[model samples]
Target: MLRRIDEALINRANQSLLNELEADYAALGDKLARQNIDIEAITRSAADFQIAVPSWGTGTGGTRFARFPGTGEPRNIFEKLEDCAVINELSGCTDSVSPHFPWDKVDDFSELKQTADEYGIKWVSVNSNTFQDQPGQEHSYKYGSLSNTSKEARELAIQHNLDCIGYGQQLGAKSLTVWVGDGSNHPGQQHFQRAFERYLASMEQIYKGLPDDWEMHIEHKMFEPAFYSTIIQDWGSNILAAMQLGPKCKSLVDLGHHAPNTNIEMIVSRLIQFKKLGGFHFNDSKYGDDDLDSGSLHPYQQFLIFNELVDAEYRKEQDFNPAYMLDQSHNVTDPAESLINSAIEVQRSFVKALLVNREALYGYQEDNDALMASLELKNAFNLDVSPILAMARYRKGAAINPLAVYRSSGYRSKMAELRPRDPNATGSGIV
Candidate 1:
């Protein structure tokens, strides 16, 4: 693999931390042994965990107010792959990148795939963007795209999604994720039933273009751009659309796209029950789609979601596999560092979930011991899994402390020299 960070530097950094990390691992293993849990098995599972990085997030993200671009921000898809490579090289968890259309479009997809392969990266779900109009576009998405009452606009949107699938096929991607900002900003502006009908009609055309082995992931958001209501506003609408589409279509859950205090874990369970959970766009949020880093806040909630995922794994539910990807906006920190940290945070949650005493928890639930059931969950959550995560990375030839090694490597400073900033460039208001 072509590693962006120096192997010698990572070796030295790991050597410095190895003794202490080993001690911690031994202690944790002993603790888990008392509970009859093999820490090695959990560590191996952690080593195997992977998540996809959002290509757009390699650049600094912004809000509606302003975008303060970071130094060495990726200017194009190729540069974005370079940054993604660094993330994977250091963290060893993000092996694929989910790309958005037009922003990542290039003339030669074969070359793009080769470049990604050189960096040991692959493509995940290809996302379609009809929320905004591209330069010289015929129709304006200002009204709507897929759900637009205008035939021209709807046709253009459907074509865009079909094109995305075509691009994904060249890049070895197996899924297409569709998230549109098509709805009404005020009451009585759009007829809800009619708008949804149009959306389904448009999606049906796109669905036909999907390859036999491919999936179509529908992502729903509560409200954005269209404040009054969003066509596919919640899981209800998302799953309904998925069911209507067929077996190849499924619902994608973005962690930030929900009302505050919503029982997202229950939503995961319900999706699993119906075998419609396609994947997740992992990120944290205080309110609305803040797009904060993964597990930056309410880590317990992230852990709970993973608990349900692990539970599904244990039960061997039919077609239980779900794709994992990080979708966050780095407005205040280095995007590379933030991605590395977020990957670790997500991996931490997965490992903790693996540690859960499922049999004991089930017994507690069966006995109706609420307090003990809660305690059982808390016990797994509270156990520090840092050693296990570090060990996994170490064994895989990645950094033991990725952030620390990245900082010491001065990679960002070097990239700043290689990739000068473009003062006239506009920001994408998202990551």
Candidate 2:
């Protein structure tokens, strides 16, 4: 059994860290010299980036076809917190956890809050699980939950979301996320208008249940359980639903929930423009909802999205802050290591976005110099900002090389011993 990794590997990664920081700082100084921008101010701004980890993601994640469970995977919420603590301790970027209802449901809400606090983990957003039916569920969401034609089924779905909101309030969570797996596989299986009307009607009740300070996030997936079509299928539908639900409702962008080659960052820009961007479920996807690690497949795309986000922040756009959370499953790697690496990857994107020569880009845009504007973004993306990231982690008492530290510590093997592997296991029902 592997014990946790030692401190040497964690400390050794600093050589590259120092080198990267030096090069980045020099480059940033040059860019600032050209435009009179403040490099120090940008570095300070980079220190403020944070994203929440999903509790469900702490466990071993598998595809619909197959799942290979990890040895020390967390079996419950408490164990999940332990994994999250490791992630935060090593990465210094993930300070919160987004919990899924029923999957993370427990009796002692107060105790859960205290436990999380002890681990320096805050509950960011409470996700409602209406995609599948739970034990003793009176209504079946077989066809759909909110969009189901059956009045009883729709009513049950509405109640479940409301209940989730109530749980969020108890847990000191400020937002509720709703992702329903409701759509049709075969043609003529459901009516479009009536189904959407039912969904809207059900959502209205859930909206009313939200506390004054709470925001409701509607997550839309193009297709999944229903291969043909899905309600809340695109950003347009998501925004329309949010508009109907009023100011408190906003659309959440899950990176894996889109068609291949979709301009997701453009969609993000549009949502920010409308002031209806609630949050994001960050991940990478090759085919459809691959739920792979963030910045693994399309790092440039991630950087581009952050480019738009940093643009909004620079302008001080109203209601510009968007919640961010990891929504990837660990199928092959240690769940803890994957999460820490993913969080750091996300931070890398944010850091790269911060490096974008905003003034130059703005000037190019004003002069209508499309090539220069494109060049400006590419310049920032091309620069490696690893040192700045390492410095931030160092300042926060995290490891310079999080994955190396985790591996040297041998945390996973220790966990395997503590929590014996399950011979016959059940799936997490994510795909």
Candidate 3:
């Protein structure tokens, strides 16, 4: 594979931190051994853990109010792949990228695949966008798209999803994610039943187009662009639609898509119970879909979600595999830096989750010792896993300190000269 950053720079960066990392890692191993936890096992899990980065997130993201462009942002899909490569090279956790339609559209699939291959990256889920209309388009999704009252608009939306699947097939993507901004501002403006029926009909057509091995992921959001009601507003509606579609259809959870203080971990447990959970779009939020970096605002919440996931893993839950991906917006910081740090934050949560004494926690639950059970979780969360994460990256031939190495390489400034700035560039809003 072609490398965007020099190996020598990474080696130098690691050399500076090597002794310190080794000391910390040995200390951590001894500490974990006291609790009967093998640090090597957790390190292996951390090394193997992977998450897909959103293609659009490589650029500067903005809110509906305004966008402040970042210097040297990717100009197109190829450039985006270049940036994604840098991320994977340093963090070693993001080897795949989830692409959005139209924004990543290209004429030659073969060449696009070749370019991605050179970067040592592959396509994850291909996201379909029917929320907004394209220039010179016949349909206006202002009212709705898949769930539109107009047959023409709905058909157009369906065809777009079908096209996305075709593109995904060529790009070696095995799933298609559909999230539409189709709802009403007024309570009675939309006939709820009929709109959902239309949505089902349209989705059925798209489902039929899925390859034998590919799955269909339906992403649900409560409100945005539509205030009063959204078609697939909650997990209940998401599961219903997934069931209606079939086994290949599953629900995707965006962490920021739910109402404030919702029991997202319980929702994850329930989705795993029924095998309806497909994957997640990982991000942090305080108010609404802020799309802040992963674990930035709610590190504990992120850890708890991973706790449930690791519990499911320990039990060997039936058909419990869920895709992991980061979906966030970088408005103020450099996009590449934010992605690398976010990937590490997520990996930290996974390592910490693995540290949880599940057997003891279960015993506490059986004895109705609520305090002990909560304390069990708290103990694991309190343990620092930074050494494990750094060592994992180091062993994988990646940077021990990804952010530091990236800055030393001067990648952003180099790209700034390579690709001129675009004054009118925009990104997927807030997410």
All candidates: CA RMSD (Å): 1.0, 3.1, 1.4
Tens digit of per-residue lDDT, candidate 3, span 164-228:
99999999999999999999999899999999999999999999999999999999998998999
Q: Write the per-residue lDDT of candidate 2 for residues 299-382, one digit (tens) a residue.
A: 999999998898998899998779999999788887787888888898889888877778878999999999999999898888
Q: Best candidate per TM-score, number?
A: 1
For 1-431, candidate 1 gives per-residue lDDT tens digits of 77788999999999999999999999999999999999899889999999999999898889886788989888899999999999999998999999999899999999999999999999999999999899999998999999999999999999999999999999999999999999998899999999999999999999999999999999999999899999999999999999999999999999999999999999999999999999999999999999999999989999999999999999999998899999999999999999999999999999999988899999999999999999999999998999999999999999999999999999999999999998778765542
- Cα RMSD, model 2: 3.1
Instruction: Write out the backbone clash pairs for model 2.
Output: 3-409, 3-410, 4-408, 4-409, 4-410, 4-411, 5-408, 5-409, 5-410, 6-408
Q: What overall lDDT goes with each candidate model?
A: 0.95, 0.85, 0.93
Worst 10 residues of 3 by lDDT: 422-431
As for TM-score, the candidate ahead, 1 or 2, is 1
TM-score of each: 0.99, 0.93, 0.98
Residue 220 in candidate 3, Cα distance off native in Å: 0.8
Better of 1 and 3 by TM-score: 1
- Supply candidate 1's per-residue lDDT for 194: 97
Better of 1 and 3 by lDDT: 1
